[model samples]
Every structure is written in structure tokens, then in C-alpha cells.
Target: MLPKLGTNETMPLQMTVGLTYDLKDDYKDAGLDPETIAELDSPATIDGLEAALRQMGFTVVRIGHIKNLTKRLSNGERWDLVFNICEGLHGVAREAQVPALLEAYQIPCTFSDAAGMALMLDKGLTKLVLQNHDISTAPFAVVRAQADIDGVSLPFPLFAKPLAEGTGKGISPLSRIETHQQLREVCTTLLQKFAQPVLVETYLAGREFTVGLLGTGDRTRVIGIMEIAITDTDGLYGYNNKTDWFDHIQYKLLTLETEPALFKSLCTLSVQAWQALNCRDGGRLDIRCDETGQPCLMEINPLAGLCPGFSDLVVLAEMAGMSYQALIENIVNETLHRYNLPQPRQRHEAA
Candidate 1:
């Protein structure tokens, strides 16, 4: 087991980290919808991550996506660890592609493993796991077709989205339905457009928040809780709001002084969900309150966006007075400690 680093302690090691990512620009001309590539990283994101890694004294290698990674691996290329942020473009197991490949080669990688990635990608499956563990989540059902919509016993005013999508790919003003007719219409459109099952859940009408976390298993800790206040006419943080967050959203960092009980509840629930899902390294968990003011787990983002100052996680870190470099260092430190690898020596005094 690796020893935890104290404030003045450090592990001296020189390592080469292979970075795996799917660039949004690479697929802009692939005849795909804009939402399809929204979760993919930008060139700026990759550049920022690479710079952070190099600053901490690690050799950084740009290994593109799974195709590029497969080619390199087949040719016997390897690294001390793979910093994977690949949101693949295929099926339910898309996000698992890179981690699964690395696992097969007995290589260590950052973030969750293949099983966790596959399970978390499917929103319906993730809710099942959460329910089984007695975790608080909204009542939901998966609709695979138009016929399945009739079988949904959930009450009206339901929120529906693609069963296995991220970055609010299938969410819109139409997602929040108040009638059976609207539900049917939205579900039909989503099923046909996304080619995936629709997850219709009892709509949580209260405040929305996302909790940032670091570490894994028993070592996992909550970094901060951020309340996502939607300022638009329609109160849904869909793709458009997320893409143009500057104008449509306000992110407030919660604290014990302002929201004592709610803040604790959100942190406790987020950590429980993260541990139950066996997520590694770091990520974020989205939570929303119901009509009765009870918080419910919305989803788990095990591989969250890392676009420096733009991503939610980065924003949360910044709000908490944690620098971007420190956020990256914390993630790297947690991974190294989990894997019993030599950790990086502290380079900067700021956090």
C-alpha cells in the first residue's frame, strides 16, 4: 500500500503519462449532430492537461482516441499510466473502450475501471445500482420504444432523456413533460434520434447541485458542492445552457454556513454513490431536489469534463479557492496513492 503524503512530505518519482482523449474537432465533419460531440474534449483542454502534467515533472504523450491507442498498443507502446478522458462514439460501452483495453493489457489508468464506466454510462442501469444499495434516487423507468411508454407508471411532469448519453445530449425544453401526449412525443423523438432507450423519471423540481469528489473507495472525499441555478425561461440545464453557460446559468458554491443541512446531505449522498459505484480517482455527482425538498441522485460523471476554467469541476475548484493546477495535482496524487505508485513531488506551494 502507498503511504499518504503529509503537508511537507512528498514522493519523488519521474513518470511518463499517456493521455487518451477524443477531440471534438475530429468529429465535427463526421456527419454527426453537435450534441454527439459536445462531451468530447477541445484542443485547448488537451493542451491545458498536457501542460499541467509536464509542470509536475511527468513526460506527457498525446495518444488521441481509442483507434490511435489501439494502434500504438499493438505496436508495443506503453506508459506508466494512462490519463483517459475518452468519451467514445459508439454503443453503451463506449466510455469503457479505453479503460477496457488498458485493463486487458494489465496497464493502470486514471479514473474508474471498465466495469464502472460501462455501468455508469447507462443512466437506467446506474439508477438500478443506486436503488439496490438503498441510495436515494428519483423513481425512473427505461422506455425502449413507443409501446414501452404506456408501461411507464411514473406520474406526469416527468423528465426524459437518452438512457446512455452524457453532457445533456438529449435534454431540452421538451424533456420536461406535463402530459401523456408530450411524454409520448418526446420519447418517440428521443428514441428515434438517439437510437437508445429513454429514461423517464419523476421530475425533481427543486434546486440542482453537483458535488465534486476526489480519491476512491474508502479514501474518497468531497471537494465541494455547487448549486446550478438555471436563469433561463425554461428551468432545465440542457445542452444549450451547458454549451453557453455564461449567459444561461449561475454556479454557486455551497457552504455549511449558508446551507448547513443540505450541504452535508449532498456531500454524504455523493460520497456514498461514488463508493458504491466503485469510481476511482476523481469525478462529480449531480443531485437534484424533489418537490418535497429532498435531494436525489441524478447521475454520476466518473469521467467529467476537464476544460480548465470552463468545466464544472474546474469552476467548483476555483470557487473553493483551489487553483486549477492544484485540482490536477490532487487527482494525480489520489491515483498514485491508490495504485501504490511513486507520487509526484510537490512543485508549487499554492492550492
Candidate 2:
């Protein structure tokens, strides 16, 4: 804890929270790749998150970019903290840029630090870290160009995607390839398109799940485990499908009554990944079962989407008995506690 609130403050202390995210603009007209734009936030995600913070009694400040944030702070503006969700536009460390900026100024912020975010961006690097910790992840390789395809050690039915992308970018039904020709063509396409090394992994054809986590260490808990089922058997939970999830995706809450051992295993794997990554505040861990039904980590979203009405994070949160407001408030409260800052008081009237 850095400092606590006191003195002549009335109506509880107010903390200025700078809400930040990358918005998907009219990129297609700009000739920007729409596939890359899918990772950016929707208007609903930004609006709903902003509304949640204001409802929690914090003074909300809209900070959209690192340059803008710096200019404002230099012009005598101050933000007690930043609510960062910037899934940056370039480089492997793009996700780390804003958090690194805030840290340099000694300003507290939400979500993981720069290193953690950077690690989470690269699928191959994240898997390496997991392997170092003796965690189970599907065997994977990185292909930077056409030459690398011939060296792939993984067998057929391999999954390929951009090494550092989220929101299902570089992932589609075509990502699952069964032959070396398919692999070569897909790898070449992804390399040229995404302009990043492509990660090729053994495809786990079993059940897929995503688990939500909150807080840190002993306080950390699994919020809920939700399985995404694709309505179209030929489709995947890819960018196209995830974007229009209403018509194609179904979210199932894993219950002990129905899943029993699988549910428990999912939760366990999620928490282990959370701890391994040294994740802070809120996060989402995606997993898929191996041929033996053992869980394997797919990806980690430390800056999990908070799209309120939609977003799997919201569904998992609601299942854990936490309202949208509570979810946002919980994030603020946990980050505040980490910084030793005074939290907004919860006052009870009459009753």
C-alpha cells in the first residue's frame, strides 16, 4: 500500500482512472487488414467498462493511447491509475507499451506488468515459459517463413496461427490442417498476412474450455469455466465465428453435476497457469483437452475483455455470483490494495 485517503475529503475519496483500449476503426477503407482489426475493442466494450467505473464512484478519464496519456500528464493532468486494455497495434511488446509507460512515471495500473503482457503476446514464448515450469502444453513450433515449414516436427492435423495475436486472429477453420501441403500453404499465407512467425501446434480435437480468474496468490480464485461450442460443425471459435458468436457460438457453464472431473481439471489448470504467469488483477485462461482428456493451455488473456452484455468474461463472472458492477469493482479494489491506495468506501444505508 502506497498511501491511504483521509483529511478533508467528503463523499469518500475519488480516484481518477484512465480507461484505455484500441478501437477498431474503419480500417477496411484504410486498406488495413480486417483480420488484425478484430483484436481491437468494440464500442460496447469501451462504453460498458467506462460506465462500470463511473458507477463505482471513481472519476473516469479516457486515455486512448500512450502518446496522448504522456502529453496530458505533462500538461498537469494526473490519473491515480490506468485501466489498460490496449491490445496494441504492432510488435510482440505492443501490449506492454502503455503499462511500461505508467510504471516509468510510478503511476499504478491495472492488469499484469509489461513483462507478463509481453510474454502472453507470443504463443511460442508463453509455451516455453510453461514448459520451463513443468506445465503441460501441446507440442508446438514457430515458423517464420516458407523454409521453416519443412522443419516442423508436429504431425498432421496441426493448428497454426500468428505467434502473437489474440481475439482469434489468424485462426479459422482453415487453421486446422491435415497435410503437409495444407500446412505449407497456411503457414506461408499467415506469415505473409500477419507479418509474424506462425505457431504450429498439435491439434487437440477434444473439448475446449476457457476459465476466468480473479485476484492474486491466496486470494486468487477461479470465477467460472465456460466451454464454447460451435453451432456449425465445420466452423471453429475463430475470428469470424467469435465476432458473430450470437448466431454461431454457445457458452456452457461447467458444473460438477455435469462435468465433474473435467470441470475440476479445468479449474486446476486455469489457476496453475494464472500462478505460472504471475498474472495480476483479472485474467482468462483458455484450455483444450488432449487425446487422454488432460487439459492443455491454449492461451492466457490477462487483460480479459469486459464487453458487459457479451464477452465470455462477463458470462463466467455472472456464473461465479458476481454482477458486472462487482466484477469491475473487484478489479479496482484488488489493484488498489496492491498499490496500498485508499479504496472507495462501501456505505450501507438503514436496511
Candidate 3:
């Protein structure tokens, strides 16, 4: 039962949610094959969220790609909450821009606000913050230029990826380097190829896991832990492997294969990492077990993927015995609960 606030007072109503999604403005510059871009861009996934919100009795508003969101929000139309899915344009600041826009309007939105998104997007900054909190993350350094790799003390088999990138953009099989020469070559390649700062980290070889968290502060709950079982491939979960490198052996789901008790430990650590970062609403923590089986934090995804079947959170939730419907409903209810909104009256209660 929900705590009673005031019986006579009507619960605040939510209406007309605004959506923001990445439109991929850099199709030509990113060298994204035109066909791939077309496939990626057109499939607007607002339907599931829309149905959920509507079922909760809210009107859904399609705010298609508010480019200058600050100026637009300042125009004075009020919304109860901005259902922020704005992953932003295909740039480094894609995730950061949405909540910044909402903050201007003082409108509460779903997921982590802009500041958290900004902090987590930069891999270097996220690791530093984790280290300060006494979190066990792999040793890492940032290479802004190829020249910056010279002073790195973290030993190889190091993993290198974009410092500010998400969605596994520049990660490839060759990202793991075993020597100084390979590091230089990979760093140079990233500088020339991706045109972004490269994050080099001492790679920890062990089982990989992901944690899904919901709510903030004490209200947070660990939904489940999922392990990334390399059932078929010999390589890491890099771009090529994730995109198309799957073989028959690598096709197994890790959660299904991992011991139930061990996975629970992973779930515990993932939530710990979320708390360490002060993440709000819901998000995901990526973790890996070192050779000794101790969990090492990788990074947090405040805007954890929500693409129904394809998302990591969905997989984690399924493993934990919750259906997709139940997970989405929980997320919506939690967001509403954050503002102290009243829950919908059940038929029995209404009667």
C-alpha cells in the first residue's frame, strides 16, 4: 500500500510528454553508410513509452527534435514532466543536452539530469569520480592526442575506446593492445579515424556483468545482474563483435549460463556503483569480474538502452523474472513516485 498524503487532495496529473531522440545530424561526416543511417533514423521508438504513459492516463506529445530547446522551452508552454528520450544528435554531448534543456524550464524529466549524463559520458571523468569514491575501477588514462599516450603507466593488454563516445562507436577488436607499439598504433588510428580522445585502461580479464538500477537514494533497487558470456567469440564485446562478429559458440546468453548466486553478487555491486555516482531515477552499471572474481566497475549508463528486446536492461530484467511490461511499468511508476504523485486507484479500491 502507498503512504497516504491527503485523502481529499487530488493527485497532480501528468500530461503531454515531450520526446527527444538522436536524429544523427552527422550522417555524412561520420561516414555512416547511407543505408545504415536510414535504417537507424526512421524507426522512432516512442510507441512503447507512449502506450505506457497513456495507460497511466497521460496525453502523449510528440516534440520532434527540439534543436534550440532552451529558447523553445522558454516560450512558456508548461508540461508536467518532460519524457526526455533526447539522446541528442550523434555527437559527444548527445546525452547531456536533454536535461540541460529541461533544467531551464524547471520541468522534472525521466532518467538522470544533464549533469549526471555529462559526467558519465566522459569515460575519464567517470573513472576519476569512481576512484574518489573508493570504487574499484580498472586503472585508466585519457589520451587527447597521440602524443598523450607517452606518459601512460597502466600496463597493457590495455583497452582503448573513445573518451566521450557511447553506443560502441569506435570500439573494435584491435582496441586491446599488448605492447607499447600496438598502443601507439591504436592511439594514432583513433586520432585519425574517430577524431576523439582515446581512453586507455588496463584491461581486466574476467567475467563481464551489467547491473540495472531504478530510483534514487534509498529508494533504489537492484533489478538483476547479467553476465556477458563469450559463448562463441574469443574477443571482447567490441564494435565488430557486437555488430556482426557473433559465431555459434558466442551465441549463448551469459545470464543463463552463470551461477545464480554469483550473479546476485554482480547485481549488488552494480547498484553500489550507481549509488557511488548519485544516479537518479534509473540507469545501468557495467561491471566485470577480475581474475580473482572481484567485481571491477566499468562505467554507468544513465541513459541505459530502452529498445525493448535489444536493450541490455531488458535482458537483465528478463533474467530476473520480470516481464518487459512489468519493468516499464515499474520505471514509469518510480518516475511518478519521485514527485509524490498518487498511484492510480485499482478497480477494487475504487469500488
The 0-to-1 C-alpha lDDT of every candidate, in the order given, reads 0.90, 0.82, 0.69
TM-score of each: 0.95, 0.92, 0.85
Candidate 1 residue spans exceeding 4 A from truth: 1-13, 348-351
The predicted structure with the larger TM-score, 1 or 2, is 1
Model 2 RMSD vs true structure: 3.1
> Cα miss at 188, model 3 (Å)?
1.2
| Backbone N/Cα/C clashes per model | 0, 2, 5
Candidate 3 or 1, higher lDDT: 1
- Measured by TM-score, how close is model 3 to the native structure? 0.85
Per-residue CA lDDT of model 2 for 204-241, tens digit only, reads 88788888888876667787888888787764688877
C-alpha lDDT (0 to 100) for residue 344 of candidate 1:
70
Model 2, global lDDT: 0.82
Which lDDT value does model 2 have at 51?
Answer: 86
Window of ten residues with lowest summed lDDT in model 3: 342-351
